[model samples]
Target: MSFTLAIVGRPNVGKSTLFNRLVGKRLALVDDQPGVTRDLREGEARLGDLRFTVIDTAGLEEATDESLQGRMRRLTERAVDMADVCLFLIDARAGVTPSDEVFADILRRRADHVILACNKAEGSAADAGVYESYGLGLGEPVRLSAEHGEGLNELYTLLAPVAETFEARAAADAPEVEVDVNEDGEVDADAPRKPTVDKPLQVAVVGRPNAGKSTLINKILGEDRLLTGPEAGITRDSISLTLDWDGMPTRIFDTAGMRKRAKVQDKVEKLSVADGLRAVKFAEVVVVLLDAAIPFEQQDLRIADLAEREGRAVVLAVNKWDVETEKQQKLRDLREAFERLLPQLRGAPLVTVSAKTGRGLDRLRAAVEKAHDVWNTRISTAQLNRWLTGMVEAHPPPAPGGRRIKLRYMTQAKTRPPGFVVMCSHPDKLPESYSRYLVNGLREDFDMPGTPIRLHMRSQSSKNPYKNKKKSTPSRLRKHIHGRGGAQG
Candidate 1:
C-alpha cells in the first residue's frame, strides 16, 4: 500500500481546497459553507515525484456521539487513525479557535505523526495568526495557501522521506515467485496477461427525494456506508463508491435526491441537483429509482426522460417492494404507467426491489449489467446493412412529390448508445415517423432493448457522367438539316 495522509482541521480551514489541489481534480465539493464534506473522501495525491493516498475528511467537531456532527467527527477520527500522517490545518486568516485547540490536542494524543499547516498564510496580514498557530504545540507550522498553490514544495519535502520508506517496505515484503511450465510447453510465469481496455461500469442512481436511492446502494454494498435517516435530502453530494458486484468491478454513484426544479428554491439543493445531473452524464447506465407506492409521478417521469435525453442507458427501479400489497395489480399498473408516461425508455428494464428488505437486488444487479452491455453493443456493418434493407423493404420510404426516395446504403457510425447513418435520396423528405420505425426495427432486430439508438439520414448526391461534354446539336439533326438544304438546292 502507498503512504496515507489525512487532512484534518476545524471547519472552513481549507482542507478540501488543499485536497483538491493535491489530487489534481475537484473530487470534493468546495463552497464557503462549513461541514460541506460530511464523509471521508480518498484520492491518490501527487507532489512532484511523491505519490500517496490522501483523504479529505469532514471538519473535526467537538461533538462525539449520536448527533449528525458527532457522526461526522467519528468518521474523521477514523481517518486520523487509518492515516500514517495527519496534516492538521489551521486558518491563519481567522486565527485559531477553541475547536482548533481541542482537535490539536486530540491529534497530539492519537495520531502517530502530525504536521501543522497554517492555510491562508499568503498575505502579510496573516502573520499574527500564523504565530498564534505555534501555541498549538504541534510543531513549526508550514505556512501554506492551498487555493493559490503556494508552499507545496515544503509539503513535498516533508512527505518525501515517508514515501521512500513506504516504497522500501513494499519492495522488501514482496514475495518470490516460482516459475512453472504449462501443458502447452509455455512458461506460465512468462505468459503475459492481457491488458484490460474496459473500465469499471459507471452507474448513477437518481430519483425524487426519499425514494430510497441511498438505501438501495447501501443494500447492494451490504453496509451503511451512506448516512440514511427518516429525512428528505439526507445526501447532498454525489458520492461515488467502488465495489465488486457479481465478479464485476463497478463504480456506483449515489447522488442527492432530485426534486422538481420549481420546488427547489435553496441554493445548496440546486447545487445538489446539478451535481446529480453531472453524474448522469458521466454514467454508462442510470437507474431511475421510484417509490413503488407512488410510481410514475411527474417528477419521476421527468427524471427518466432526462436520462434518456442524455443518451444514457436507463433502468427503472421501483423501490419499496416489500411495502406494497396487491403485488400483481401493482406490477400491472406500473407497466402501463411506464409505457404510457415514458415511451422514450420503451422496453427498458423495470425492476422492483425493496431496499429495506434486500429483496430483488439480484435482479437489479442483473438488469444493470445487462443494460451496460447493451449500451456498449456494436452491430457489424454487414448486419446493420442487412437489417436496414429488410426494414426498408417492409416499410418503404415516403415518396414526396411523386418521386420515390431511394435509400442506398446504411452503416453504424458508433456504439455506446448505438448510432447509425444512412445514405438515401431526399433525406429531408423522410418523416420523423419513418426514423422512429427504423430505430425501433434496429432495436427489435438486434435484441437491444432499453438502449438508445440513433439514426441519421443523408441524401445521396446525384452525379452526371456527361456534364463536361459541350451541348452540340445532335449529329442526326445536323445531317437532316444538311440533306434538306442540298435537296432544296
Candidate 2:
C-alpha cells in the first residue's frame, strides 16, 4: 500500500531539496536559481517505516495566462490534484512572502490533506520567519532544513498517520488472490523470465529543442502533463511515464531538447543535457524526432549517430508532418537525406507524425517495437557460420603481403544489438571496407536492419606446445647411450 506526496511551493523555496531528501536520491535537478524544475518528477520515498511516491513539481507562480509560467503553474496544480497529500514548503530564512501566502490559500482549497513546512529553519536567523508562518492559518508548521537534513523526524510523525489510513484503504480495496503451495510447503512464486504484461518496454523520445518532444508525449498521454509553449528549452529534465501503448506495456521518457555544445553555456542546460544522455543510455530504444520542414540537419545527424554509437536501437520520426504541403516529395527527400546523411542507419524506420493532431503515432509505436525486437535479436552459430560462408564466397577477404586471409569460423558473441566474432588468418589485415561489407551482409541476411551490429575479427594462431621446454643435456644423453650399450651387451 502506497500514497503520493507532492511538495509544492514558490520557486527556489527548497521544494526539490526536500523532495531529494525524502526520496533519498538526487533524482530531481536542484540549483540556486529559481524555476530550475519545470516538470513533475516522481520518485519512491521512504521515511521511518513509511513509504510513498513523492512528486517534485514546478514552482507555483501567480501567472494564470497561457505563457510558460502559466502552463507550469497549471502543471503544478495537476500534481496537487493527483497527490494524496501535499507538503507546502516555505522559506524560513526569507520569511513568508505574498506569493507563499497566495499558494497556501490555493492548497487549502485544493488539497485534501496539507502538511505545512517552513524550510531553512536551521538557526536563529530563521526564527522570526518560522513564527510568522502561523498567520497563514494552515496549522503549526513543521520546522525543516532540507539541506542540512534536520526536522525530518517531525515530518515523519505527521506522515505516519496519513500513511496508515492510505494503507488500510488500499488493503480494503485490493482484490484477493489464492496461492498454490508446492511440495516443500512454500508458495510457488517463480514466474517466467520473458517480457510479459508485468514488464514494460523502455523507450526514450529524444531530439533537439522545439522538436515537439513534450507535445508528442502529451498527445500520447491525452493530457497536458508537461509544460509546453512556443518557448525553446522549456523542458530541463527527462520525465518518464508508464502506460499501455498500443496494447503493450511501455515506459516512455520525454527528454530535454539537446542543442549544439557551443550554444549550451548555462549550468542548468548542461545538467539537463547530461540527464537526457543518461536516459538514452538506459533506454532500449531511442526515437530521434525531427522537424519535417528541416529534417536531417547537422545536429540531427549527430543525434542519430550518437544513438547508434551508444548501441541503442534507433527509430527516426519526422514531426509536424501535417504542416507540410508536399507530403510525398518531402517524405521521399527525407528518406534520401536520412540514408545519405546516416548511412550507418540505412534501413531504420522513418515515420512522419504530428504531435498536435496525434497522427501516425501507431506506426511510430510499431516501428519502436520492431526496432526493439531487432535490437534483442539472437542468431544461432550454425546460421551465422552458413551466412559467413556465403558472404566469403561472394567477396573474399583481401590478401595482404601475398598471404590469403582465410575466413575460418563465425559465431555470435552477444545479442541486444547483435555482436559477432569472426576467427580468421591475419585478421589485422582486414580492411575497413571489407568489415563494412560483412556487417552490411549480416544486416541484410539476418533481417537486422538499422540496429547496430558489432563485428570483431581475430587471428586464430596455434601456439607450439614445446616451444618453451628445455632440451636434454649432452651428459644425460651420453649416460643414456652408455646404459643402452651395456644392456645390449
Candidate 3:
C-alpha cells in the first residue's frame, strides 16, 4: 500500500535531478547532455516523515512512428497512468517547449493529480521561463532548482497530504501482518499481530552502459545527483542509497556495469567490476539490467550465476524496452533461454522496462519485493527434519569405512538463501553427491526451487578428560621369576 509519485518531463528537463533531490542521494546520473536518461527508475523517497514510492521517468518525446521514441512515449504514458501523483517538470532556464506542452496535455488527460515544477529556477533570469510554464495550465508552478536544491519545502508541502491519505487507505484495506522468530530462529505461526517494518529491503541495480541504471534511480529519487553521460563506464563505484519505497524502507545499491573479464583491460574498470561484485555479495536481491536490444549476454549470465552462488535473490530487468521491437516474442525467448542456461534461478522474476521512460517500474519494484520475501523465508526445524527423513529414505547415504554415517539432528542455521546444519556421526565422511542431494531435496520440497540451499554437517565426539595420566611397571616380577627357577632346580 505504498503511495507512488512520478516525476515526468521531456529529456534534459531535470526529472532525474528532482528525483535525486527527493531521495536524498546522487543515485541518478546527471549530465547537461540531453537523452542521457533512458529508463524509469523507482526508489523509496522521504520528505520529512512523509515516505512513499517515487519514480523518475525518462524524458518524453513525440514519437508517432514505430520507432524508439514511440516506445519511450508509450512507456511514459504508462507511468502517468500508474502514478497517484505526477510531478510534471520543466526547465525554467530554457522556457517551455512543444515537448513539454504535449506531455502536459497527456498528463492533464490521464493523471488524477499533477504538480507542475519549474526546475532550475535559481536566479531572476529563470523567472521568464517559470512564468511561461503557466501556459501548461496544470497549476501555480513550484519554481525550484534541482541542481541547487532550492525550494524543496514547497515540494514537501505539496506531497505530504497525498502521502498521508494513501497511507490511511492502505491501513484500512490490509490487516497488520507480524513476523516473529523464536530463540531457535523459527517463525512463530501464532505470534501477536503487528505491522511489518524492521529490516530494510536490500536491492542491487546493475547493468551495462546507457542502459539507464543511474537514470532509473534518479527518477525514483526525484533528483539528478549522480553524474550521467552518453559515454560508457561513467560509474566506477557501487553507491548505496537508503530510502522508503511505498512505506517500505529499502537500501538500493547502484553498481557498475559488468563486462567480460577478458575484455576488461583498464584498472579502473576492473576496480568497478570488483566493487559491483561486492554489492552483489551484500545485496539480498540483485536486479540485473540488460539492454533490450542485447539482452542476456554471456557476461550477464556470469553476473547472474555469481549472484546465485552468493545466495542472493535475482531480478532480471530488460532496459530500453521502449526502443525494442517484437517485445512479446523477445520476452518469451529470453525467459526460455534463461531457463535453459541458468536453471539454478528458475522462476526468477523478469521485468521489461524503459528506465528512461519509467514504464514497468512499478512492476519491477513489486517483483523485487516478492523476491526479497522469498529470499528471507525460513523453515521450521521440525518441518526440515521431516522433509529430511523422506529424502534420506528415498536415497540412503553412502557408507564410510564399512559403516553408514547416521544423521542425528538437523536445523536451519540461517536464512536469506536458507542455510542448514546437520549433526552426523562422521561429518568429514559425507560425500559431495549426498550433500547436493540434500540441498536439492530441500529446495524442491520446501517450495524454494530457485533459491540456493547450504547444508553443513557437524560430527559429535565423546571422550573422557581424566583417563590416562601415569603408568607403573611391575619390576619385581622379572627378578622373582629368575630366583624361583634356580631354587626349584
Ranking by TM-score: 2, 1, 3
Q: After superposition, how far is residue 379 of candidate 3 from its true place, in Å?
A: 1.6
Against the true structure, what is each candidate's TM-score? 0.88, 0.91, 0.54
Candidate 3 structure lDDT: 0.80
Q: Per-residue lDDT for 22 in model 3?
A: 82
**Model 2 agreement with the true structure over 271-316: per-residue lDDT tens digits:** 9999999999988899999998778878888999999999999999
Q: Between candidates 1 and 3, name the one with more favorable lDDT.
A: 1
Instruction: Report the number of backbone clashes for model 2.
Output: 0
Q: How accurate is candidate 2 locally (lDDT)?
A: 0.90
lDDT string, candidate 1, 340-427, tens digits: 8887778999999999999999999999888877887777788878887888898898899999889898887877788899999988
Candidate 2 deviant stretches above 4 angstroms: 177-198, 464-489
lDDT over C-alpha atoms for residue 285 of model 2? 91
Q: Going through the candidates in order, what is the number of backbone clashes in each?
A: 0, 0, 27
Per-model lDDT: 0.87, 0.90, 0.80
User: Please, what's the RMSD in Å of model 1?
Assistant: 6.9
lDDT of 2 at 441: 89
Q: Which portions of model 1 miss their true places by more than 4 Å?
A: 173-198, 465-489
